[model samples]
Target: MTFENPAREEIKKILERADNVAVVGLSDNPERTSYMVAQAMQARGYRIIPVNPNADEILGEKSYPTLKDIPESIDIVNVFRRSEHTPPIAQEAVEAGAKVLWLQLGIANEEAAQIAESGGLTVIMDRCIKVEDAITGPLKK
Candidate 1:
């Protein structure tokens, strides 16, 4: 079966209620797309938890080596990793009890989507969270 993302209104609601975002593969460098997107989301009031194994910190937030390393609850697990690498992350997000599994633009993995969905996560694939927030966020300025 073809993978279809949730409708726009549903995505809006997800952004509205979300408070914490665990950004997997978020980069320390400001030039990276992951860094820029997470920074914008942070400015919009969502707590940004950087999940980067190689970085000590990103955007002033302490970086965790994995989703399981995060101590608090996660509203969204936003991923910047390649499609081939997402299935394991999906499992981790499930283990971490995240509400949503969001794969960033240009990345989508069927196995990952299935895993997250089976684990009760609302999955959004191949969409830019930053753009979605700007378009549909109630907290947008």
Candidate 2:
């Protein structure tokens, strides 16, 4: 089956109600795209939870080795890892009970999308969360 993202309005509503964002593959370095995107999202008032095993902390938030390690509820599981690596993350997100699974730009995995969708999570692939937020406007608090 072909993959299609949720409609713009649906995406807007998702962003609007979302409060906690768990960013997988978030980099410790400020130079990485993952860092930049998470930073932008944080600036918009979303709590950014960094999921990086190698880092102790990122963007002032304690880093977790995996989604299951996060103690709080996650609204969105924003992934910066490669397409081939996303299926497992999707599974993790499903187990974590996250509301949405978002794959970053240039990354699309049909298997990952299927896993997320089947697990009852909203799936968005090959899209930049930062760009989508910009177009969708400031998130509701």
Candidate 3:
């Protein structure tokens, strides 16, 4: 069964309240989609924490090897990995007490979304953070 997500108003509320974002599977290569999206979000005034085992830093922020390695509380877990890899990441997001689990464009895992939602996290799938931000205007308090 597919779960209908929270309304746009609630999503906007969460986005506005979120300050720290953990970008899972982010890459150092500027040409990659993950890097480009991260750059865009950062430009939009969000604190982006890069999570990648392959890099020490990306876009001037220290990169963690995994979500668990990120010390601070994360408001959103922006997943850049494939659908098959998402359940574990979703679990990590839950364990880390994240409020949102965002699956980037072209990536969706219903099971992961269910798990995240079951764990009380807001789930956003098959969406681009940058596009959403641009279309929704700046997040309001």
Candidate 4:
């Protein structure tokens, strides 16, 4: 059977409670979708950690070459890489102690989801994190 993401209520809970989001495969270019999405999340008060090897910084945040390179606790790991490249990212996110693994729109990898799920990290595949937060609105607390 194909994998179905968590229920909407569950996703909303995750969005409401999380803070820092490490954007894997994030791009420094303003024209890229990753940059735009990450910016939107940053505007909404979610700390956006740029995870790109090529850039020293993006959106004024220090960019790490890999998820494992991030020193702090990662609440969410939003991925922008291709489907074929997601499994390793999932592993790194698990190793980095991330609470969630979010694969950006158009990226869905069952193996990666399995890895994350087995590692105790919540998995959101083929969904936009920024859009989810917009839909869920601000937390009531």
Candidate 5:
């Protein structure tokens, strides 16, 4: 399965509009990329939900084991897991009613992107939310 990516303008719109971002595969280890990215997002005032089985807390917020465990509706699911592991996470993000599935820089899975898109979720692959935030602007109106 395959589909076209949202245009640069549309991707920017989605990123600018999204509020709560659930960071799947987030880690408590401060050295991890997910942790660093989540912290950056939080510092910029975006709600960052940490999803990791190994963590109870990260960046002073409660960590969830999965996307389904997050109480609030997530605007975007920033995936930090490997490409091989993204399909199920994408499925979970869809099941959790996320508006977008964002695979981090260097991570891309056409199958997962297709699933998320087919389920009415916007998909952004091989892009870093943190980088996007830096280059663009806050996810705000």
Candidate 6:
């Protein structure tokens, strides 16, 4: 059976509980979607850890080459990578002990979803975390 993502109730809870978000495939370029999303989330209070091979920093946070390289606890693994590149990141997110594996818009990898699910991670696929946060923000008011 194809992996199904979590419902809105669970998604809201994940956002409410998560304090740190590790952005995989994050880009330093201001024009990039990853950068924009990460920047917005960072501005909204969630700590953004830049996980990119080339950059040493993004949005004032130190960058790491891989998920396994992050020394601190990760509340979420937010991926901007292609579907094909996501399965390994999913595995590494589990190894790194992240609570959630979140895929950006238009990205969906069944294998990665399965891996994350088996690793006990709450997986959100083909959806923008920033968008979800925006949708749920009004409820807090």
Q: Which candidate is the best by lDDT?
A: 1
Tell me the lDDT of candidate 5: 0.88
lDDT of 1 by residue, 1-141 (tens): 788999999999999989999999999999999999999999999999999999998999999999999999999999999999999999999999999999999999999999999999999999999999999955643
lDDT string, candidate 3, 1-141, tens digits: 976666677767767888898999998999999999999889888999999998999989999998899999999999999999999999989999999999999999999998898899999988888887777677432
TM-score of 4: 0.96
Per model, state how many residue pairs clash.
0, 0, 0, 0, 0, 0
Query: Model 5, 48: alpha-carbon shift in Å?
Result: 0.3
Per-prediction TM-score: 0.97, 0.97, 0.94, 0.96, 0.93, 0.96
Task: Score residue 120 of candidate 5 by CA lDDT.
Answer: 92
Estimate every model's Cα lDDT from 0 to 1.
0.96, 0.95, 0.89, 0.92, 0.88, 0.93
Ranking by lDDT: 1, 2, 6, 4, 3, 5
Question: In candidate 1, residue 37 scores what lDDT?
Answer: 97
Candidate 1, residue 134: Cα displacement in angstroms equals 0.5
Q: Give per-residue CA lDDT, model 2, range 1-141, as digits (tens).
A: 999999999999999989999999999999999999999899989999999999999999999999999999999999999999999999999999999999999999999999999999999999999999999986555
User: Candidate 4's residue-wise lDDT over 1-141, tens digit each?
Assistant: 689999989999999889889999999999999999998888888889999999999999999999889989999999999999999999999899999999988999999999999999999999998888889888323
Tens digits of per-residue lDDT, candidate 5, 1-141, equal 445667777877887788899999898889988889998888887888989888898898899988889989999999999999999999998999999999999899988988898899999999888888777764443
Question: Across residues 16-125, which tens digit of lDDT does each residue of candidate 6 receive?
Answer: 88888999999999999999999999888899999998999899999999999999999999999999999999999999999999999999999999999999998999
Provide the lDDT at 58 for model 5: 88
lDDT, model 1: 0.96
Off by over 4 Å in 4: 139-141
Model 4: pairs clashing at backbone N, Cα or C within 3 Å: none
